[model samples]
Each structure stands twice: as C-alpha cells, then as structure tokens.
Target: MLQRCKTLIVAIIALIFSQQALADTAWDSYKSRFLMPDGRIVDTGNKSVSHTEGQGFAMMMAVANDDRASFEKMWNWTRKTLQNPENGLFYWRYNPVEAQPITDKNNATDGDTFIAWALLKAGNKWQNPDYLKESDAIAKALVAHNVVRFAGLQVMLPGAKGFNLNSYVNLNPSYFIFPAWQDFADRSHLTVWRDLINDGQKLLGKMHFGNPQLPSDWVSLYSDGRTVPAKQWPARFSYDAIRVPLYVYWFNHNSPELQAYKTWWGRYPRDKTPAWVNVTTGDTASYMMDGGLLAVRDLVLQPANVAAPQITAQEDYYSASLKMLVALAAR
Candidate 1:
C-alpha cells in the first residue's frame, strides 16, 4: 500500500509538469511568429515596426522562459542596431526591412534602457561581464544626454538633437527607463531607483490623471512646474500603468496607497478585457500585449492572501509571464 501511494504521487507530479510544459510551448510559438530577425517584432500583417515596450515585454518573457539563445540573439541585435551617438540614446523608430533606425531624431530612451536591463539580467544569469558592462554604458548615456528640463520636472526627451521637447514629457516616458533604474538600484548603491519613483510619482500626481488608471504617456517638462497636457497624444492606460501599481506594491506592500491602486483596478471586471482605458474613466479600449503581461505580474505579486483574481487571460502570448508567475509563486 505504501509503495502504491508513492507511485501515485509521482505520477500526479509528472502529469502536472507535462501539462505545464505543453502549455509553455504553445505560448512561445504564438509570440515567436511576431519576432523579427533583428529582434524587432513587427505589427501583424503590416511590416511597420513597433516600439520597445512590446519588445521589452517579450524579452521579459524570454527571460521568464529561460530561453537563453533567443534572449542573446535579440539583445545583440537591439544593441548593435539601436545605439545612437548623437544623444547617446537608443533610436525609437527603425526600418523594418534593413533593421536600421528610421529616424535619428526619435530615440526611445526607455526601450534602450529596458533592453540594457534585460541584457544585464541575462549577463548575470549566465555569469557574463560584457553584457553587464554594455548595460552600464547605456544607463549612463540615458541619464547624461537624453534628459530634458520641463515644468520643474526633469524628463526624458523624445530623441537626441532637434527632437521636439514639447512632445515628450508625458507619463509613458517614465515607464520606459524606470525598469533600468529599478534594476540598477542594488548594484550602484545609488538612489536612482528612489529618484525615479519619486520623480514619476511627482509627475503622476501633477498629471491629475488621477484614479490610478495612469496615463499611457505624457509630454516633456519645462523649467517651471507646469505641464502641457498631451490629451490627444495621451499614452493610453494599459499594461504600462500596471507598473505603477506593481511598484507601489513592491515597495509599500499592503499600505493604503497600494490598496488604493489595486482597488482602482478592481473596479473593472476581469472578463471585460480591453487594451487601453482612459485613466479617469476606466472605459474599455483596444487590448495590447502589455496589458496581458501586466496582468500576470499583478496576479503573481499581489500581497499575500490578497483577494485579487489570478489572470489567465492570454495563456499563450503570456506564457513567459506565466513562467515568471510560477517562479515567484514558488519563492
């Protein structure tokens, strides 16, 4: 009887593992179709390239999946092709065909930083120093050259020389480079993490895009503490906004602020999935990949015993997120 019980337990464990393995492959395949040779995943059916957020989010998935080869190829392509000398930043728009930067004028500072962060993570995982060093260089460049002064907030400008500062100061910019700032906090022993959080919070507060739905993006800041609302160009609340909530929870835990943010999200039914929502209204908008990624993070990292629902929305596209969730859950 004892031997039979042990065999049953082992079989159950094997069954569960097999199911998870198959599920992971399905998700990986769904995302892999969008991936480009140079690591840029183009819009479906259209050859036009997208920005770093999706690319970064996908890379996060790669990290989650422990796909070292995929991670390496993407990171290498991003660094070699995207590095910009003029602003010491990473160019935002790239040509899909040749995988070359489209506009020297539009550098995506956040994407650059995020890629550097992913590379650093990969380096650390594999015990390689070169990737770490490369990450460090990009971090320095983002801080040194791409920052713009606006409305009393120090903001990341859109591109290097001659780019429009007035257009870049919105909330979306904060999300782009913040991951790198958070990642660097432990290594450099600097308050870059706190600084970014505080600065972003300050900007978030100022936007008065209140209600915790967070703006998709924002405009550049000026010398004085005033903002020019990019209402039309708002970054659109989606997965990016979830970072603010996640950040608050990570640092503040179950504090009122974190609860408030979570409650704000709770107002929406999980069944009514949309890509974007107005920060104030919570109305449904088209869905995007970031929304799915953010959902995974929120579900896995919710304060212990918190009553938030576990998101199982897009199982395949979000497989990387699922792996991450499992890892965190195990921890």
Candidate 2:
C-alpha cells in the first residue's frame, strides 16, 4: 500500500510539472515566433510588417505571462522606434524593407490604447512609476488629440489624421477597446473615457445593420447626426470588426452588445462560419474561420467552465495571439 501510494504521488507530480511546462512552452513559442530579438513584433499575415498594434499586443501578452523582461524589451523598442516624442503617441506602422521604415506618422488610437493599458498593467505588476507615468501621458495625449465630440457623444477616431473628412469623421467600431477605455476612465478620472465607453456601446448597438445584422469594419459619424458604414471602406465585417466581440466579452461577458455577435454568429454552423462577411453585398468569405477566431467564438458563446482551446504551432501570429488572449481571459 505504501509503495503504491508513492508511485501515485510521483505520477501526480509529473503531470503537474508537464502542465506547467506546456503553458510556458506556448508563451515561449509565441515570443520566439513573432517577437524579434530587438523586440518588434511581426504581423505574419500582413507581409511580415511590424505595427504599433502588434507591438502593443506583444507587450500586453508579455505582461499577462509575467515576463517583465519581454515587456521591457517591447516597450523599449516601441519608445525608441515608433514613439513621436513630441506628442507621446506612437506611429502606426514600420516596414523594415523600406528606406524609411516609418512611412506614416499617424497614431492609431487602438494601438495607443493597447500600449497604454499594457504599460499601466506592467507598472502595477512591477511597481514601476515610470511605466505608469508614460501610460498616463499617452492617455492624456489620446484624449487631447484622438477623441472628439461627434453626434453629441465622445468617440475615438481610428487615428489622429485623415479620419475627419469635412462634415463626417471615420471610425472603426472594433477600435473602441472597451476595457482600455474603462481603465483610462478610472486612472485619469476623466468622464470623457466613461462617456466614450457609453457612446461606444451605443454606436456598437446601432452599427449592426444588414441581413445578418453585424457591425461593419468602418463607420462614418456625420456632423448632421447620422452614422453609417464608411463610403470609402468596404462594407464588411472582416478582420478589423471581428475583434469587437472579443473585446466586449473580455471587458463584460454579460454585455448586451455582445449578444448581437453571439446571435449573428449562431446562425451559421460553427465549422462553416466564414472568416468575414460583406454586409453590403451579402457575400461570405471563401475561407473558413481560423482557429483563433473559432476560439473567440467558443469563448463568447460557451460557458466559462468549458476550457479554451490550446494554441498550436500551425497558427499564425494573429490567431495564436487571439488564442493566448482567450486563455488569459478564461483564467
């Protein structure tokens, strides 16, 4: 009896260690695959280019995994390479192949939010005042530059430049970044962030307007009190819009705004759900939904007890990142 008990304990210990190993391996593999030595994160799906969004995602993930070294590396790279020191905002994109790596200096609001949120979290986790100060500065800059009162509610522009077209301003609903907004609201004591959240939820509720009734990737907020899909962008619920539900679910799983996504997605069989939908043309994507998207679908639709799917080597940067995020939220 004693010998048998000893063997069982050994087996249990091995299993626990194995499980921990697997968790570490997943994060380690993600860092190795997508994160460069210099801390830039490559968007594998987007021609291996680096973007502020990617860097922010990486920094957030690093914090989630409690990898302070990785977080610092990513932050350092971002500060050195992408930050417009004059304004404390980051440039949206960097193409290593180009003679001028940063061809555009526009600040993507969503990217700024993500980075600020990550910095705040890292500061709290590591007790670093510098990170917190930087985050606060970025938050203030966002409020000063990217946000505007349109149609009687505060709304975040997708970027600092080119979004305002005379009487109308272009917006991406997915860029709302609900959790980050909430954090900013609390940290900055700015009612605008709270107002933005409320307005964002209202915008999200109304943007779903098609046969299937889903939010478009881009929308226009007009001066004369109208909101519709942007004329310049395709009227589709594609890559950008897919993130809406994920953010909503993360911030508030019981949110009524999330129900629209759940209901619309429920119409299609899980395996047959397309990667995107053209709300204007009523056309679906040719390809099936990827693992990351499917993981998000399951997360939003299923009960919390159901375990999130594991990340695999086959997945790309975006998909793998989504899977990791879902796993983090699940915890």
Candidate 3:
C-alpha cells in the first residue's frame, strides 16, 4: 500500500510538470506571433493595432508563465504609451497606422481592471512592491472614473465616459470580470469591489433576453432597475459577451449563471455553433465561432477537454487571446 501511494504521488507531480511545460511552450508561441520588440502586443486581426486589453492579457500571461522580463517590458511600454496624464487610468486603443494613433482619450474599464488585476497577481507572486503600488493606483483610478450607482446597483460603465445618461446607463455584461473583482476585494479590503461583484452577478442573472435567453454584448440599465439589450449595438451575444462565461467560470465553477450558456451551446453541433445569437430576434452569427469561443465553451462545460493554447492557423487576435485565457484559468 505504501509503494502504491508513493507511485500515485509521483504520477500526480509528473502530470503537473507536464501541463506547465505545455503552457510555457504556448506562451512562447504567443509572444512570437503577437508581441512586438518594443513590448506592444498587436491585435493582428484589427489593422495590427494595440490596445490595453491585449496588453493586460499579455501581462497576465507573462506572470502565469513566470516571464518577469517580458512582464516589465510590456508594463513599461504600456505606461509610457497609454497612461493618460490627466488621470492614472489607461487609454483604450492604439493604432500604429493612424497619423494620430491616440486620438481617443476614453478609458476602457475592462482594460483598467485587467491591468490592475494582473499587476496584483504579479506583485504577490513575485514579491514586488512597485507593481503592487501601481496596481492599487490603477484600481483607484478605475473606480473613480467608471464605477457608478445605477438602477440601485453599483455597476461599472464600459468606459470612463459616453455610457452614462440621465435615465439609463450602458453596461457591458462581459466586463463584470468577477474573478478580478474578487482579487481586488481580497487584496485591498475595499467594500466597493465586494459590492460590484454581488450586484454584477445579480444584474447578469436578470439581463437574459430573446428566445435564447442569453445576455447581449451590451445592455442598458434604467433608473427603475429595468435591463435590456442596448439599442445602439446589435442585440446579440457576440465577441464581448462571450467572455462572460469565462470570467464567471473562473469565479465559481458551479455558478448557476452558466446554465443559459450551457443550454444554448449544447443545442448546436460543436463546429456549427454560431458565434453570436440575437437575444431579441433569435438571429445568429453567419459563421461559427473561432477556436477561442470553442475553448471557452469547453472550459465552461468540460474543463478537462480544453486544449492547451495553440495558434490555430489563421486565428485572429481575440480568438487566440481568449484561448490563452481559458488555459490560464483551467490551470
């Protein structure tokens, strides 16, 4: 019995090491494909532009892979290039081809949250105080600029501005980012993070629409606690809302919020699952999801089936990034 127990322990250790090795190889491949020499991570599918979302994702990836040098390189470039002088928060997008790349000064709340969350993880993992300080600053600025009271709920706007109206506020349900909110609450002991997490989850449970009864990419919350898909955008659960499940699953594997997605995705064949479904009209994406969405689906339904992050031929930036994210959360 003792010998058999020893053999089982050794096998478990070997499996862990093997999984990490696979992850490291995937990280290297991601760096080669998208990370620029100067630390900018290009969105290869979108005019080769860079954005805070990609940078944050890469920073988290670096920390997960234990690539300290890459993390610092990316952080330095991001600070120098994207940080707004008037505010500590980061600007959203950067287009290299534009003569004036940083024309838009709007701060994306999701990007800010991701950066702060990744920095916190890096700080704790690597015992770096500077990262922690900067992370707190970003989180503070994020709360100052975007977090707001709406419809009797503490919700985060999709950006620093342009979403708040007199009677209603626009929200991206995908930006709930539950796991990161939990980290912030744990690290800072801020009741605001806790409030956001609780209210955000409840809001999500109420935002389902159309025949599919899935949350849309964007929703409008009125003063009376009414929620509906925002009219300005397509009323479909597409690129952005897809991550809702990924983040929720990260926070709670047994969360009831995942049932709608599970039911919807389960109705379609694996390859034939449409990328988005209009919650109002029951419309669906013309084409199926890329490898990333599939990875997210498996992560929600069967984590054991999620493959390691690999660059599928012709996969775009968002697809590749989400695939990496799923792998990170699975481990």
Candidate 4:
C-alpha cells in the first residue's frame, strides 16, 4: 500500500508537468527563435540588435510562463550589458556589430518601467526579496529621471534627453505603459504612479488627429500645453502609436482612450487592417498588420474571444512579443 501511494503521487506530478508543458507552447517557440544562449533577445526584424524593450518583454513573458530560470538569465544579461551604472535605467539599444555595442546611452522610459514591473512581479510570485529590492531601486531611478512635468501635465518623455527641449517635449504615446504604472502604484504605494495614470489618460485623449481620429506615433506638446504631431517625425500613426491601445486596454478595458483605436481598427477586416496610417494626411500602410498587431486588434475589439495564442515559426521577434502580450492580457 505504501508503494502504491508513492506511485500515485509520482503519476500526479508527471501529469501536472505535462499540462504545464502543453500550455507553454508559444513561449517555447519564442525562446527557441529569439532568445540567445547568453539570454539576449534578438530583434530578427531589425538586424539582430538587442534593446531594453525586448529584454523587458522577454522577462515579463518568462514570468508569465512560470519559468524562473529563464527570467533570471534575461535579467542577469540585461543588468550586465545594458544597465548604466550612473543611473538604474538601461541604455536603449545594443548593436553587436558595432565596436561599442551601446551606441545610444539615452534611456528608454518604457523599457525601464516594464523591467521594473517584471522584477516586481517576479519577486512577488517567487517570494524572493532580492528581486523586489532591485525593482525598487530601478523604479526610484525611473521616477526620478524619466517622469517629469511638461506643459502643466505630468508626462513621461521618450527618453532621458533630446526629448525635453525646455520649452516643448516629445511624447511617445506607447511609452505611457499604463499597466506598469498601475502595478507600480499598487506595489510601491506611490501617488505619482496614480497621478501618471490619470494624467496620461487625459493627455492621450487629446492626442487624436485627422478625420479618422488617430494618434500619431510621436506627439509634441508646447510649454503652453498645445499638442501636434511632432514636426521632426513623419506624423503617422505607425509603429509607436500601435502599442497605445494595447497598453491602455491592458490597464483598463473600459477606458475611453480605446474608443479612437476601436473606431479606426473597426473600419477594416482582421486580415485587411493596415499596419499604420498618417493621422494628418489620411494615408495608410499599403501592407497589412502582422500577426501581433492583429492579435492586439482582436483583443481590443473582441475581449470575450480569448483563444490560446500560437507563434508561427516565421514570426519576427516584435510580432511574437506582441502576440504573447495579448495572450497575457486575455488571461
């Protein structure tokens, strides 16, 4: 009877492992393709460069997949390679082909927030105080360096520099990173995060442009609080603004901010949806959105149809990351 009971326990454990394996199919594919042995995630679509955003995205996915080992690998590499000793924030990109991989020392605020949020989450889930401690340090630096007041509205800049021109500021709508802000507010008990959430939503609500009413990829706000499509950029609702709705819906599904995205996306069928649009001139991408963008569109429009996500073998790093993010949001 003792042997039989032991055998039954072993069988149950095996069954549990098998079930978990079945559910982690997408993560497995993503890791096999993009994740290098050194824990750097490659941007296959962008000449195999690694960035803080990709590192944060993978770390978050590792936590979601319940893979602590993978998360540690990514965190270790990111901290070693990208982190700037002067500040807790990471440099934006690493080009392996360049003599100095870190060509840009400027920090991307979204990546910093996501990394902190992932660390906070991993620390909570795994009951490790070390991860939590590091997360706090990073979070403090992020709040100190990136979060700032522009035009009487508390807004986050695209990076640490060049974005704040004293009299005006450039904001990337995608960088608002609503879910991370919410998590920071809950965990750190910081009023600034809460304030950011409220103010960010309001600012984004006023950013829509053109007849279709879409936000541009990059927007500019003057000291007087007036907004326009950044003169320096192409003034299109392209890659950057594509993530705005994803973050917003993840933070609050019923957000009025999603209305513009929903309206614009609703005009096209799932397969025919354009990759981007010129919010000012009404021009649109001749090519359609990739699998990841489609996944976001589906989630934004039809929240109830939460099907399991799959990663195609040919899917690029960014698209796969987006699809995985949508799957997490769906859950």
Candidate 5:
C-alpha cells in the first residue's frame, strides 16, 4: 500500500511538471520564431512585415504567459512605432524596408480591440493603473472613430477610413472581437460596447452566405438594409473569417452563434478540412487546413477534450499564434 501511494504521488508530480513545460514551450517557441529582439512581431506569411495585429497578438500572448518583460517590450514598441500621435489609434501596418514605414495611418478596428484587450488584461493581472488607463484611451478612440450606426444598428467599421463606400458601409464580421467588446463594456462603463455586441451578433446572423451559410471575410451593409458578400474582396470564408468561431467560442463556449460554423465544418472529415471555401462558387483551396486552425476548430466544437496540437518549428507566425491561443484558452 505504501509503495502504491508513492508511485501515484510521483505520477501526479510528473504530470504537473509536464504540463508546465508544455505551456512554457509554446510561448518560448512563438517568441523565438516570430518576435524580434527589438520587439516587432513579424507576420512571416505576409512578406515578414510587422502589423498592429501581430503586435497586439504578441502582447496578448505575452500577458497570457505571465511574461511581463516581453509584454512591456511589445507595448513600448507599439506605442513608439504604431500609435498615431494625432489620434490614439494604431497604424494598421509597417513595412520595414520603406523610408516611411507607416504609410497607411488608418487603424484596423480588430487590431485596436486586441491591443486594448491585452492592455486591460495586463492591467488586471499586474494591478497596474497605467495599463488600464492606456486601455481606456484606446477604447474611447475606437468608439469615436470606428463605431457607426448602420441599418438602425451600431457596428464596428473594419478601419477608421476607406470602409464607408457611397451606398453602403463595408464590415468584417470577424472584426467583432466579442471578448474584447465585453471587457471594454464592463470596464469602460460604456453602453455602446454592449450595444455593439448585440448588433454585431445580429449582423453576423444576417451575413451568412453560400451553401454552407458561413460569413465571408468581407460583407456589405447597405442603406436599404441589404447584406451581401463584398464584391471588392473575394467572396469566401478564408483566413480572416476563420477567426469568427474562435472568438465566439472564447467569449462564450455555449454561444448559439457558433452552431452554424460547427455544423458547416462538421461536414468535412478532420483530415480533409479545406484551407478556405469560395462561398458563391462552391470552390475550395486545394490545401488542407493547417494544424493551428484545426486546433481552434476542435476547441470550438469539442470542448470536453480541448487538446491543442503541439507547436512545431515549421509553423509560421499566424499558426504558432493560433496554437498558443488555443493553449491559453484550454487553460
């Protein structure tokens, strides 16, 4: 009996240590592969360019891993490099090779939300008022510049500029980062965030297209109350839209909104999952869905055994980020 008890204790201790190692490895691998020593996070798939989205993702991941040093480094870089002095919003992208790196000063609302959300989480975790203050500033900026009333509902613009075409406003349903909006609503004491959340869900429900009925990366909301896939962009459920279900599941695993995505994705065998789908044409990319996307799919659909796939060295910045996010969500 004594020997059996000792063996059981050893096994438990090993399991705990193994779990800790796995957690550490995920963030470490991400930093080594994607994050530069000076703090910029490279989107390896996007010509190694750095974007506000990647920076926000890094900050959030760093905070999740409880790596204060990395979090501060990334935040400082963002404030120095991306933050627009005229407005608190961050620039959408930075091309390092250019003499003027910040050519496009417009802000991506999703990126802004991610940065604000990270700051808020960091503030709460570290008990730092400064982080909270910065987060509030970003949240206010988003409200001032990005939120708009369309078709009798408040919605987030994909960017601070260029989205409002003459007859309609273009919206990206994935830009509605549900968890971030919820946090901002609670912390900033702003009812707009709550209203945005409700309107966002309504918009998402109406945005579904194609045979499987999934939202596209881009959609148009017209003054006449029509919603359709944006003609300017590909009418497909691809990279950007893949994040919809992930965010929804993160905010509320039991969300009714996730059912359509779950049902659509369930039609394919796990190994045969397509990288993307052209909703209108009934066409799909030849490549299979990467492990990272598959990891998120599993989390959203099969929550009980939420096992994030192991992060491999070959995975690029986005995939690695997804894997880390899954690991964080699982915890």
Candidate 6:
C-alpha cells in the first residue's frame, strides 16, 4: 500500500509540474509589467517615449489582444519617428515626444526594415495609406543606401557609403539584407529577389570557420571572393545578429542552407548563457537584457540557416521570452 501511495504521489507531482509549466501566471505578470499605462506595449523605461521596435512589438501584442488603443499608439509612434524626408530613409533612433533622431548615424538598415514590415502589416489591417507610404519610403532607402555587388556576394552593409570590396563581411548586418530585399520584392515587384537570395546564400556559406566550428560576427572578404581573417570584427554577437536565423526562416522557409544552419545552432545550444555572444566562437561573453532576448529567442524559434538546440526555459527567461513570443506570434 505504501509503494502504491508513493507512486500515486509521484504522478500527482508530475501533473502539478506540467500544469505549472503551462500556466498563465507568467503571462499575466508580463502583461502587467511590460505594457504601458495607456495599454500600449512599452519598454521598462516608461519615462522615455516608445521606440520603433517597442512600438512594433506593441502593435503585434495589441493586434493579438484586439486592443485598438494599443495598436493606434504603436502605429502612430512608428510613423512619426521612423519616417525621414531629407534622406528618404528612416532614422535609426529618435525621441518619442519630439520625434527627432537621437544619434548622428543611422544604426542599421534592419531597424527600418522591421519597422517597414510592421507598418506594412498595419497598412493591410487598416487599409491606411500613410502606413503604406512610410513603409515604401524606408524600403526605398534601404535598397538605395546598402546594396553593393562583389565578385560572389551582392549584399547590404551597415550604412550606405564606402563600397569597400576588401572590407571584412559580417553576417550580422548582412542578415538584414534579406528582410529588406523581401520587403522590396513585396512592395515594388522588383527583379532584385534573385540577387538577394544569392547574396544571402553566399554570406551564409562564408560564416562557418574554426576548429570547434563557429561563425563570427564579421569575416574578412577579398576582392576575389576569398574569405580572409580581419581582426577588426567585434567579439560578441548583439541581439541584432542573433535574429539572423529568425529573419532567414521567415523569408526562405525551404532553403537547405538555412536548415543546416538551424541544425548547427541546435547542436550546441545555450540560450541562457550571456547577453552578448561571440559571433565568431558562439561563446557567451556579456549579459544585457536586449542581447539576452536574442538567445532566449533561439529557444522558442530560430530562423532558417541557423541551428540552436532547445533548453529548459528558466522562470525569468520564460517570463521574458514568452512575452516576446506572444507579441511576435500574435502578428
């Protein structure tokens, strides 16, 4: 009888654990803390106004919850902050209240690209001309500024300026090329799609290196398409680079290269390791929340051509990750 009772208790305990795992308690906590007073999705720094990424994520969440106010707040904020008339490209960062660029240089084309994507969705959902127009302008700027053709790789760079063929190539910025190109193909019906895919494949092919076999944030490129060592590359992979797989999977679902990459990341997976990961070695280096989300994302879903093994999502990680997942999934 004692043995039987012990077995029953074990079963009950397992059931309880499972229930806790799938519980909505974490979701509730996230909803309360992350969302804004007006029901818009917000970053923790509520004192400052919203950002394009935060607004975009908020829009996704709002759409998920059927929250009209949240959606409007996001859409309005994005349209105002991202659109720039002088350069015809979206500014990378801006103050919410004043709607002015925060920094001198535009950070990455991907920021605008993602904003364009969210805006495009908003346009579709509400049939808004303003959203469509802004999205098109950002797409135009991304293509205009970033495109450069080398012997083998036709890719996008961090900013539109020097056509340095001998410069080192990083998969981090290159990953944005696909998303921007996809958006361009979608909006303008251009013939750049083939070039975009080729560029992506070539870059992905070049990312693999080293004894333990890890990819770096950047790679040295020769005019002859020979990959070389450029010590100028950063040691860590930011949140931006980590999303390479996410973007790739979203665009080319069936690419073998992406599939292989995903499998590779899955093999040596460590989602909770550190905020900043070494792009070259896949080593955990630093710890910041923004970069932390990138690793956390791999646990839930990865892009094509990147591999990441799933790990037990910790309580804190799960709470943070699930909220982002919910936001993204809702879109």
Give the clash count for each candidate: 23, 0, 1, 0, 0, 17
lDDT of 2 by residue, 93-128 (tens): 999999999988899988899999999999999999
RMSD of 1: 5.4
Q: Per-residue lDDT of 1-331 in model 6, one digit per residue for the tens?
A: 9999999999999976764444334334545555555543444444444444555444544544445655676566555556556666555555535544355445355556666666676776777888678777776676677766765667766655433545444334334546446656867886665676666667666655543233455555666676643466664444444555545545565555455444544554454334545645656655534323543345334433222112233323223533454234322
Ranking by TM-score: 3, 5, 4, 2, 1, 6
lDDT leader: 3
lDDT of 5: 0.87
List the candidate numbers ranked by lDDT, top first. Answer: 3, 4, 5, 2, 1, 6
Poorest 10 consecutive residues of model 5 by lDDT?
302-311
TM-score per model over all chains: 0.70, 0.92, 0.96, 0.93, 0.95, 0.65
Worst window of 10 by summed lDDT in candidate 3: 306-315
What TM-score does candidate 6 reach? Answer: 0.65
User: Which window of 10 residues has the lowest lDDT sum in candidate 1?
Assistant: 305-314
Report how far off residue 119 is in candidate 6 (Å): 1.3
In model 4, the number of clashes is 0
Candidate 3 per-residue lDDT, tens place, 128-154, comes to 999999999999888898999988899
lDDT comparing candidate 4 with the true structure: 0.89
Q: List RMSD in Å for every model shown.
A: 5.4, 2.9, 1.6, 4.8, 1.6, 7.8
Over 39-153, each residue of candidate 1 has an lDDT whose tens digit, in order, gives: 7655442355666644555665576567777777666666566656655566665666664546544666557766767767777887889978877777777666665555555
Model 1 residue runs over 4 Å out of place are: 1-23, 45-50, 97-101, 148-168, 173-179, 207-216, 219-228, 232-243, 246-257, 273-275, 279-331
Q: How does model 3 fare in lDDT?
A: 0.91
- Backbone clashes (count) for model 5: 0
